[model samples]
Target chain A: MPERIMPGGVMSGVIEAVISLLLVAGGIFVFIGSLGMAHLRDFYMRLHGPTKATTLGIGCMLIASMMYFWSVDGKPDIQELLITLFLFITAPVSAHLLAKSGLHLRLKHADKTQGKPVELRPEEVGDKPVPHPDKGHG
Target chain B: MLSIALYITLALVVMALLMNLYRLTIGPSLPDRVLALDTMYVNSIALIVLLGLWLNSKTYFESALLIAMLGFISTVAVCKYILRGDIIE
Candidate 1:
């Protein structure tokens, strides 16, 4: 009963309230990000959706989880910390690779897109193609 | 009070996953499908972590971590295959 009574004060109530708000905020961000991904007109434009908002959304959720564990168990959950780090690192890399593949395929561009990359013919080269730097290993 | 919040968060995250599924199925192009799949996995990870919070169980922690790792690897591998026509040199 003493342990239960210990966590029922005004300050703890405030902390729990904040955690609730964060959970809602994070979920909302995730919902919006997915909405953009599904509704966007072009693949390239869709790439922007999950990369930014979703990453932030998950970050907020993890932070709330971390705090919750700390408050309940009296120990910080370091795994959430590691997960946050991994997520931030990977979200961009995946987005970049997806976009890169789309560009490599020369997928259709939106009507107003500018600065589309032009494929240069072999004869249009400014100079001879340089040999691979590591080809001597052969 | 906290449980109610957890329930709402769970509902929203599931809705996001549903959107991802919609994109994956209705995709016009292969890369678009791949992108949807990638987002789906990430959303699942968030869902799993949220479940862990609600259950207050440490068990789901490792699973969430593993999903994060595996999801990233699979996404990158698939993207590479699309980009280069092969996953390895």
Candidate 2:
């Protein structure tokens, strides 16, 4: 491994190692998350993967980005942190909203899903009157 | 080492993006497609960050941040539309 000599004579080997580790780890998590998104049998089941796993994956990558910029610029970059915080905050909220919308639509769930609702009648969904995708269009 | 790691990460993120595309394409219901899109945004953020590191470019930082902000807003808006049949009502 060739050593990288930073502008200020900073020892870059350790920082680079840490960055590389974080990058590789984050990449793997990201791939796993996407894999789950693609291969899952049901919508709710598919929701489980990217919401949590990909958020953490990006968080790892952002941290490595922070470290890389900090080492090069000789100052900690707060922008990456902003993204990390934004993603962490929004990921769950979006997931919740997605699930709620799914519920509102009475989307089908896999039979094997533990705790799957036995039935979702339209009236039980409340006064809004759930829009039936079939009756409205076809 | 860092560049090599960046390249590897870039490839992985690209693959992730492709998988997300697959989900978006075949999602059976509206919410499913929306979820796929939301995941796509997050994956793209990772992709942008990886590119920034690979090119040693500082300009990509703002773009990444912008993507994060916009992606979240769009996801929320679309979800709200799905739930209420309208965004602002």
Q: Please write out the lDDT profile of model 1 over residues A1-138, one tens digit for every residue.
A: 012222533328877888889898999999999999999998888888899999999999989888777777776779999999999999999988887777666678797765454654332221233344677533
Residue pairs with clashing backbones, model 2:
none
Winner by lDDT: 2
The per-prediction i-RMS, to one decimal, reads 3.2, 2.0
Structural similarity to truth (TM-score) of each candidate: 0.87, 0.88
DockQ of 2: 0.62
Q: Each predicted complex: what DockQ?
A: 0.62, 0.62
Across B19-88, the per-residue lDDT of candidate 1 in tens digits comes to 9999999998887898888888878888988878766677888888898999999999998787666776
State, as a TM-score between 0 and 1, how close model 1 is to the true structure.
0.87
Model 2, runs deviating above 4 Å:
A1-5, A115-138
**TM-score of predicted chain B versus true chain B for each candidate:** 0.93, 0.92
